[model samples]
Target: MNKILIVDDEPNICNGCKLILIEEGYDVDTAMNGSEALEKLFEQNYDLVLLDIRLPDISGIDILKQINEKRLDCFVIIMTGHGTVENAVDAMKNGAFDYITKPFDDKEIIKATAKALENRTLARENKMLKKQLYDRFSFDNIVGENHQIKEIFDKIQRVAALDSTVLLDGESGTGKELFANAIHAHSKRAGNRFLAMDCNTFSPALMENELFGHVKGAFTGADKTRPGIFEIASEGTLFLDEIANMDMNIQSKLLRVLENGEFKAIGSGKVQKTRARIIVATNMDLKKRVAEKKFRQDLFYRLNVFPIYIPPLRARKDDIPKLAYHFLKRFSRETGKQISGFSDDALEMMVNFEWPGNVRQLKNVVERLVIMSDTHQLSRGFLSDHLEIKRKGGVPDIQTPKTLDELKAAKKKFLTVYFGKIEAAFLSQAISRADGNITLAAKNAGMQRSNFSAMMKKHGIVADKSSD
Candidate 1:
């Protein structure tokens, strides 16, 4: 049940409001003056407070100030006999939810109470959601026990407390965003917004507008004034992914913001200041980009204040089983599957195979395995045919020969005929799975299209015309 407090000097008004609110299923309390109201508020939390502007001992506006000073999370409605527009405006500016006159109707009072309680509930729910988000991205939630990962964790603990510009350098699919979120969650600004933008996803003009915003008459299609990421993320954190792909002109503007803490809207003359902490990520070598004159050297230096390098999945092979099982459990819960675990052979193959797509590719493969398997245990047979083929280095189901002579003869014979056949079959399956698209086939096989096609030609295989 919602709790409500009615504060008024008039005994009749206090009793009437208490009775009405109680009948409406609220636990209501009455305070005869501002002093009593403050005492009650400090004792317990209430969902809504009906405050009177005129009190014998103290003014209600002062009580409002006290509530704010104490950081009380309750809705306030001003009830006043002197219902001047100036008084109502002042009350609202001081955090009053609504203002009611002396001759207020009973229905109006009930309506205001209900609306205030509703808003209170919404605020509580938002707080809970933010807490959940913070917990989800906390450093402890990052799954890895490797030494390199532990070092990164320690670095995050030290870096998060400071308000420095962070540059994350890593390969594609190395989970740079995950590290970024962990940083923000552990930072002093965790309660504020964490906005992420991909530099490679937008064109130069659109990216500029997204970062710096625009005025009403800024461009042909701009209908009204809009705040950019910098404004929206004020006193928070802004994550820029693929930062090397940003245009050089925009890089200069971003550098200016970093240097002066101020920026102008696209078509506005007014300057605005922002206190957003910037964290940028890139897969490319930024130093190389600067040397080639593709990226601004000054801007790169500005962003590289505190650099963090995330190693790829191949480099962190020890974390493969942990990550694989982590993804398995997640996908199993999501898809309503009851997969127990992977077989020893399956786990070995996964650990041995090179994941060119890194952790992202491993996650995709795990999800696919979970969706396709019917048995509780994931075995080598359940693994992707390409991965199995890569592991065996030839066709699967080959039996070992009894003697060295037999082994040598079988190996030669297998090499003469089975090699070309198995290679062709593998290429055919990849292309067919990709709907005869060579580019996609090569990508799935973790090979360049030219290399995949050359192997295909060597095996006397040709792509279908429909593939074009």
Candidate 2:
């Protein structure tokens, strides 16, 4: 049951509200003055407080102030007489939920109480969700002990509090967005939305509309006015992924927003302001793109205000086992599987293989192995065939090879065949996992579709009807 405290100097009014709320299934308490109400609040928690503007001992507005200052988890509804409605409105500005006049209707009071309770419930849920998000993205959750990764963590700690434009530079699947989320979660804007958009996913016009919103009739099929990510993410953080793919015109507009903190919606001449913190991530070298005139130099410098470079999985091989087991545990719980762990040989194979797709590839591989394994522990047999092939095609034993030239020839032959086989297996797995959808396979492998198709063709793997 919901708890409510009714504070009014009039005995009849207090008794009437208490009886009505009690009948509506509330644990209602009545107080004749602000002092009694404050005393009751200090003693126990209440979900709603019906406070009167005119009290004999103390004003109800002062009680409202105390409630806010104490950070009490309760909604205050100001009760006002006919001429005192202005004071009740002022009380609302000071954090009162809604004002009820002296001749309060039973239905009006009940409706206001219901809405306030609903808002209170929503507020509690939002707080819980924010806590969960913060916990999930906390520094403790980032699974890496490498020096470079530790440096990144330190950087995140130092920069998270500052409202600066951050540029995350790294290869795809290096968890740039994860770091971005961590930064936002640790910032003052944690309670607000942490909106993200992939720059490469939309065309120039659509991207413009997505970031800057549009008025109704702005373009074809724009039937309704829409608030863009920038507008919606106001007072929060906006993460732009694959930012190097943003068009030059859009880049110019974005630079203006960063510089002036203002943007005009599409088809609207009126300029609106935004305070959304911009954090951008790019897998490509942005400086190179700027040099090539593909990306704006000004925008590049603007976003580079606070640069954080995340090291790829290959550079931080020591973190592989930890990250692998982390994913294993996560996927196991998610899939309700009880696979214990990986065998030494299986782990060694994973560590030795060049993870071209980086952390994402490793995670996908682990989830696959966990799903496929029916045993207590993962063994080398559970490892990808590519790893086994590479292991078997090792350097030839040259104990009897007397000539240096002959040994060099044997090494070269082994490398050529070994690399060819690895390439074939890698491409085939990517294609097969994508169900022959070349575009999706290329994206998963973090390669251009054309390049992926070329590699597939080099290995004599033809695209089937499923390629569509």
Number of clashes recorded per candidate: 0, 0
TM-score per candidate: 0.69, 0.78
What are the clashing pairs of model 2? Answer: none
Looking at model 2, which ten-residue stretch has the lowest summed lDDT? 459-468
lDDT of 2 by residue, 1-468 (tens): 999999998998889888888889999998998889899999999999999998988899999999999999999999898999899999999999999887987888889899999999999998988899899999899999999999998998899999999998887678888999999999888989999998766779999999999999988888999999999999999999888778789999999999989999999999999999999988767788888888998888899999999988899999999999999999999999998898999888888777756787788778777887788788876675323234443643334456888888767755655666677778778866864455778999999987987886454444321110
Model 1 scores a TM of 0.69
Candidate 1 structure quality by residue, lDDT tens digits, 338-366: 99999999999898877755777788788
